[model samples]
Target: MAYPFKEILQRFWGYTSFRDLQEDIIESVYLKKDTLGLMPTGGGKSITFQVPALAMDGICIVVTPLIALMKDQVHNLLKKGIKAAAIYSGMRREEIAITLDNCIYGNYKFLYLSPERLETELFLSKLAHLNVSFITVDEAHCISQWGYDFRPSYLNVGNIRKLKPNCPVLALTATATLLVVDDIQEKLGFSKKNVFRKSFKRENLAYKVEYSENKFNRLVELLVQHSGSGIVYVRNRKMTKELAEFLTRNEIPASFYHAGLDSFVKDKRQKAWTENKSRIMVSTNAFGMGIDKPDVRIVVHFDIPDSPEAYFQEAGRAGRDGEPATALLLYSKTDVSNLKKSFTNAFPEKRFIRTVYHHLMNYLQVAIEDGIGRTFDFELGKFCKAFALNVVQANNALNILERSGLIQNTDTRENNSRLYFLAGKEELFGFQNQRQEYEELIKTILRSYSGLFSSYVYISEQTIAGRTGLSNEQVYQYLVNLDKAGLVKYIPQKKTPTITLLKDRVPENIITISKSIYEEQQERMKRRVDAMLYYISSDIICRSQILLAYFGEKKSKPCKICDICTSNGQQKDLSGSIRKAVLDKLNRTGSTNINELIRDLTYDKEKSMEVIRFMADNGDILLEDKQIKINS
Candidate 1:
């Protein structure tokens, strides 16, 4: 099948040429084959499907769980003169029906929706009438039980493929293990294992790990030395701020980001960090999923990540512009201990999981076989306080329930306040004149914004308040009154977690959390944790090779720039065995007196002392009084 891909790219994206494997992946899909494209974080994964869908004859159905991403892409596509529509939770039934009707009649080239939407009777009944050129499964890793961040909703995509059997499926993911790769293909029912992978090797990004006694000082020294835009990843919201302030105290301009922040604050801080107004961004893993600022010089992990997939995805954010960058992990013994505890907390017992599910249903007041298509704003702190549940354990149980397909909670809250005029201009004018009380607010809104009658427009409460000389709270009340009066359709701004029930509330006993969802996933987490543990401890292989081999790449050349490779010469002289033996003993046992450790080494006394001194100087070991210990 011949495609005018270059013309489409030039016309819409203004790209003169396609990146490494993009054209090939697009061609394979264009030829009506089930194709999986494994691209890294910065790889042009979207273009593989979008360009081909545009070149084809019909609309492309995109299934993804990221509502924010769907809206963003649909908006960008519309800006490029390509009609696109997105259907997700929180939309009124009438609004969804209108969108589906538009897709059936209008020649929209793209229809982006959540995976849960595919099985809806409304969507399925309309599916037969629409010409779907292809199906694009974004974040395709979620279909695999072994993949990090698995979502049960993604499994329904195959059923949709069976309905549109002629339409090819293009699965795209940023990170996947070998197990996840095969699982994705099998679960998606591929005709054959036709996969296109852009190599995961980032030559410009050097991977490094350090065992340090004082990680904070080490972090500061790294930032001082590197001197460019970098990210420091900590574990929780509180730590993000503390570390960012720590960096600032040391004269490093920094910002912090987490899911808990207000949407406007998030945007402001993110813009500052990305535009180089802030030299460092100390954040949780929540930051940097879809952000596309290349040329990041370094990424510092203050704590260890459980999975290599996550580590790779987060670390890949650096060196995206192909310049020299470094991914540095600073770990201590405490961090390793914390990571193990986290693994246990991430998968609670099945009975406890069931109990949490029951409590969750009760808390939401969802009756059995009811509220299947409903969405409720969820606040973790409030729920935990009411149930007296440990925040971490309860949150983990909810995730397990989500993986079991009972409900889904997108932990991030978004969207600003939106208003749409329900009554026409004449009717609104007459009501405002008669009501008299709502006159100024109505006039203020009418003069301040456009498109109120046509569609939903994002309106800021603060902006409205400033203009009308009313407090923000008062403005909110007035908007609610107007909504009740049928003068406008108002959706107040939300920054709370939202849970969407995918299935009717079932009894806790009947909720079957599958072995694949629980046991195998637990085992997968253990493997990822072990691999990460080994990656830090191993000195015989290059750091990059350890990460690459984890993702199924073997026989890659050593990146002579990584910590292991760069230190090889010293290791050759001092004997890597000496460094390995000292660390191994410490890991097995606790801190040992320096005299006893030296005696146990069995090497020449002076040589043993030399190795110990080298380690201590490199910040890998610490000595207090006469006792010696591994730094982390």
Candidate 2:
């Protein structure tokens, strides 16, 4: 039977056709086969699952690592009248329970969950009860160590097969190397027969690199020359703010985006940029995922990214509408040093990792097996002050721990709320009955949550404490005691996001810096920088050919519209007459001062400088200070 995907596509998303590779990926998943999708950033990845899920009978579960993206996708689906929901780190227990129940019994077609949620018994058990048709892992490259952004939570996805032995898996990413692709397939348990990939080539984007002493002025010139909307990517949050301010002061309509901004501000700025209310956005890497703006004409990288994967993904954000667009990178020699510093900052010393791990375990007051589903309020500065560890070292250790998968880290800006049953309730409660104190808490929860017996509801702990006339501490103690009893669930209200380390402690002997890994990363970084430099320095190759080759494609000729190709024909006329005069002078004298050479030839100082610069750039002549030598 045909999956009726075409009909579903029109009925739901109102698209008359599938964008390239969407149909193939959808067909693969619909047949209960595994797939690896390598579509570029704006290539309609969501439709690959959304259309197929509508045709299937059971729920399609999407595992995403980004909380903001989860919410955005869920909201979009909900607006389209599709039954969709998400469970993320900051949600209350009742909220999660209700969303899960909706998936089990309601007409929900898609359910989204954070990768970190997969480790919980509560989630795993409830997930087993749901009739899930398929599992889609977004940003699938994160499962591989070779990927630019590797998350430890992504590693836990291999266990999903244990829960649903036969569910087809679909892995998706915008950018992945051969190593990352292989790692994703192996980690996700996809059979060789099931793997699928699209080529990583964007033909319409014109790649150019300008080699000038002043890149900032070059950027301003390009922005003024370009017609449509644009994006400028910087490596740090501080640069995002500063560059956006600088452009605004210069009267360009621009805004800045980064993770440090409040959600409300970020959302407002993002919307303004998306809707074209703002012509350009200056941002850190935080700005691009799930963004659907199709007419971005230019994408400029002010600083080099650490790897090619990150560079491709960020640059791919441009030219989605398919009209001619430019991807430019402004890199200097210092960018390499900056990138090395960033890598070191991202992975700290193993001793620091162990210290942070112990501190977290002590703060939570629980052993390894007992801490699942428990939430803790974490303040990094306070922890650093108490432990006497450098803040940078502590933060890096926390990052490594999170990567190791010992805990769930919630990094959202919203404050989370904690809830537990006033007394134990029986029917809704499943799992975690192993402890006795939890049984009493479940009893208390049952009596307390009257509405929970029938349906999910949010109740404030203060209200329960008020009714019981217990002090806040006593209420919390009883809740913790009940949580230990497994009768009532307790969720701690998180004011800030916590970073969960994958390991309780770093191994003493483990090498954080290996020569091989360092060399490999250095090579990847060098490729990106070289590509940028090639765009700036190459005069013979077509700008398009250079760019296409970087993404693993080969084009035969230059794009006629690029500055070099367009100027080539006219350049001969201007250079022919000047070349004759220069050659005659060179024949008369072996070498001469540039001023004397120009004066003898009657060329203006500006024209003399231009000719020398071009010759030096193209390697036809060598210049050292005022002296010039013709190449033999």
**lDDT scores in order:** 0.85, 0.71
Model 1 C-alpha lDDT versus the unseen true structure: 0.85
Q: Residue 271 CA error for candidate 2 (Å)?
A: 1.9
| Candidate 1 lDDT tens digits, 537-571 | 76545788678877877546667889878884864
- Counting only residues 3 or more apart in sequence or on different chains, how many pairs clash (N, Cα, C under 3 Å) in candidate 1? 1
Candidate number with greatest lDDT: 1
Model 2 ranges off by over 4 Å: 211-216, 358-373, 385-393, 414-495, 501-632
Give a tens-digit lDDT track for model 2, residues 472-496: 5766786677568654466654447
At residue 132, give the lDDT of candidate 2. 88
